[model samples]
Target chain A: MSFSKEITIAKSSVPKVALLVLATIFAFGIFEVGFDQGQLFSIVFGEQAYADLYIHELTHDMRHAAGFPCH
Target chain B: MSLFITIILLSGCSAGVIHGLVNLALVEPYLDKAIGIENQHMFASGEAKDTSQFWAEYYSYRAWQKGGQLLAGAILGTAIGALFGIVFGYAKNILPGNSFAKKALALAAIMWITLYLIPFAKYPANPPTVGDPETILLRQMLYVSFIAISGFGALGFYQVFRRLKSKRFVAVLGYAGFIATVFVVMPQNPDAITAPADLVNGFRAVSLVGVSAFWLSVGLIFGVLWQKLQPDRVKQARFQ
Candidate 1:
């Protein structure tokens, strides 16, 4: 058998809209885990009137776990 | 097979989360004490709540936070680990036989150094009370940019090494030069450390331990799983 395996980058097998949606979800996930400090969603949605400490506290451990510097 | 890979990655992440939680439990008292000391003035001046009441609320919050951390770890691990698994699977073709775990561990070590240690040495993680709330975004951006630069720099070094396989001496010099330049050019945070020294040291120790445990567990578990699930790949690797 040959040692080298052929590798190729294929065009989208799924619809453009679906891919876009998936990309958006991935980006949001990254933001929530990495950048948000738990307030990104609320800030984006203009929910300044309400305080949600739960998400922040929950993600605090995660930030430390991922070494994102949650101090 | 893809689903199997995802499951394996998730399991590895679960192990990582368990290790992290245990480390947190071991270090929790010291951390609580540090936080209390750092904020004692606030409590005394009525700026912060009482320590007893705070601990009660904090422990309860942490009990729930455990579940969130596990979920987040699972999601993040599966996403990143899937990509890692694919690349490692391909790399198996080029490596010697029965060395998958060793190679994986090597990669994990490098990742730990470049991704966390280097950036962290420059700008250590501060606790919730350390910095201005407004500057949180800027601090996070700076830290992440450091991680990105280190990661790409490591990858570039590997590429350069491969391209100059005929001249090992030149490759070594080139890599050293590149790394030195990165160290010189990487921006430094000039902010003074205002937190108590012991508190900062305790937090840094625990945080590093937790992250190191997670990465080590992920690498070992994933490597073993991949080896067992795809023995044929290993056999092929031996001949190559």
Candidate 2:
């Protein structure tokens, strides 16, 4: 499809996608910090690991909400 | 139920691939760089016949070692984001228009990053014993660049979904799937995880988060710069 059409569609959908991304971030964040389940938390980054894998997931969500793939 | 199961399995596969690459190939070298111990000897330590395990162990160690700042950043980002979401509760407040420019810029950035904007070091750590170090690092750089760029690509995909009649639940599914895969699939134990690191020793803590934060900030900063550089024609379209 034309670039213009994609933009128009993206513009129209921005709010919804952004909202969803925001919600997902919130849900995961709260769960990770508030609950702090040892088994799940440790496993997520790998042993001796300390990353919040959800960062990628949240970025993925941001892409989702933005309306199109980067490529 | 069947469809959900299939989706779950597929998600796991994607995440598993992402996990191995991030930890082993990326994290290992960075940790070694930080501690001045980057080398390929660690990969030779065990039966890590596969490169995947090497990378996973490297990343896990760094992740476990994160300092207080990153922990605070992640926590802060989550809290602030949630508060913003709550304050801007209405759907209308979600996104802006004329997103093409932002997307186009994002695409251009990814492409450029894939080609350039990558990391290099004084010495090769993992410097795989079998392959030439230069060739190994080049291939690793390309792979990581692709993965980083893929982040924007995934977002663009979601944009299309919203344009299509806009199914709320499907979007939610996308988010849930992403979160579950990332949070649950990463390795917890450096030794237990099958991956091996080319680096000589364990790295400082929280290197994983540092890597992502650096990249994400790059995206955000690039996004901001693009927003500034963009002509009024594009910016005006967003509001129209």
Candidate 3:
């Protein structure tokens, strides 16, 4: 008995859903790591989030290490 | 389709974790040294008190920030990897390499040069004590804008590169000239460097190493995964 394998190449078009997902991840992750000034947590925590700077503090070291503007 | 996304995300996450670990070991020392300088300035200016309470809070938060370094690395890595995957999906065939792994590595290097090194040359990374709080927003805008210009500019010139089969060198020269012009036209980082030269220089050197590791790891991992999985192909069996 002999076995043969057939390979079919798919279209080159990048899936739209995949693109959207990747784009969203790109935006959200960059904002969180590079530019977040407590804006994320502010949704629930309100003004206190800005003062607390939870995301800012959490990402502080990486912020500087990764070359983003950090105070 | 799911497999493609999985490979992209997994490679990104893994590379990012590696980037975080690398930062922890190599970059953390510089961060501590710089933050120490910031603490001394705070004490001198009465922005913070040098007391047991302050020390306690400081240690606690420093621990938290250090832990977050790894988390942030993974996050940033994934974000960058997503962008990489999108590009690879489109440009894999056109890229100059015989294998997926080679192609991935080539693209990674290009991105590292265009998106990172060039922008970094304009606005190099600084330690914590270097920047002024007042000018941070402006600095951020400048940095992001420069990276965007470099990235999009490269993309635009790549089109010219594809169109001109005979003298592709012109595309390279054109991009170089365009970026040089932008570099001159762009505003400089408004904040002055107040930190010690040794600390700032050391921090930037190590930061470059950490980021370089991420790009390398992402390229290798993503390429290997893509090669092994062949997510874009479907295989069927026929028996005779």
Candidate 4:
């Protein structure tokens, strides 16, 4: 007796998980670099984060260079 | 899928780092010059003293920010690259060109013009002292809104182009007209240009160069990586 088998594989579709992950990254990274304003640090440092502006100062140069509005 | 995401991110990070390095060389001087003007203004206004302590803190913060330029470039590149990857994934078949690299480059150029260049024309980059602290939120909203409008508008028009069998140029004209109207209708930056014209102009020029370099690098790198990896290809074989 003889037996025949067939297989097919497709990877054409972009997985939703990957899209979601990339979207999240895109949003977070853009926010961090372009419009952070100490908001990220404020998550941990409370109100004082507003004063420190650690993320803001760190991204200050690029923020201006990349054309994001900055004070 | 993992490979797909990995290559996309890798290309972005690499391009971003390149962008950072380029900015360090081309853009840093203008930043320094602008900040110098800002320092003088602060001294004159008595907002800050030109003392050793002030200098120390200024240098320290400036150093941190200078370093952050590269880091931020990487982050921004990855972020934008992710968007590029997603778009490329969907549009690769339709994009003009024989190779992935060429197609990616084409897409990059399109994006650079729509997302960055047009918005930039409406709200060009300004140096530190150019913007008012009180109006920061409003300015941010304006910049982001313009960018979103341009980007989404391009996407919507692309759909129109795709559906048309001929005279796709109509969609192109439609987009141009739409954007032109928006350019006229949009509010201005609302901030006064107090900085020296030369300094502000120079800064804007370098800023354009830096961003253009990032887009070019991301496109080329992502294209090459995608071509090499063939992440979307999966082969299965069976014999009897």
- For candidate 3 chain A, the 10 contiguous residues with the lowest summed lDDT are A4-13
lDDT per residue (tens digit) for residues B26-85 in model 1: 445554555556568677888778668887886787676656666665555554454444
Determine which window of 10 residues in candidate 3 chain B has minimal summed lDDT.
B231-240
Instruction: List ranges where model 3 is wrong by over 4 Å.
Output: A1-11, B236-240
Q: Score candidate 4 by lDDT.
A: 0.90
Tens-place lDDT per residue, model 4, B1-240, is 899999989998888888888889988999999999989999999999999999999899889999998899999889998998888877888788898889889999999999999999999999888999999999999999999999999999999999999999999999999999999999999988988999999999999999999999999999898877778866544444
Model 3 Cα lDDT, one tens digit per residue, B18-89: 989989999999999998998999999999999999999999999999999888988998999999999889
Error of 4 at B147 (Å): 0.8
- lDDT for every model? 0.59, 0.35, 0.91, 0.90
Model 1 / residue B160 / CA error / Å: 1.7
Q: Write the candidate numbers in order of decreasing lDDT.
A: 3, 4, 1, 2
Docking quality class, candidate 2: incorrect
What fraction of native interface contacts does model 1 preserve?
0.21
**Which pairs of residues collide in candidate 4?**
none
Model 4's CAPRI class is: medium
Q: Rank the candidate models, highest TM-score first.
A: 3, 4, 1, 2
Q: Tens-digit lDDT track for model 2 on B1-240? A: 222222222222233233333444445454336333223344356534446766786556446533322343344344333323222222222333354334433433433232223221111122112233235335444433443343444455456555668565576467446534643443221112122453322322223333343334433433343344422223222223
Specify the highest-lDDT model's number.
Answer: 3
> Each model's TM-score?
0.74, 0.27, 0.95, 0.95
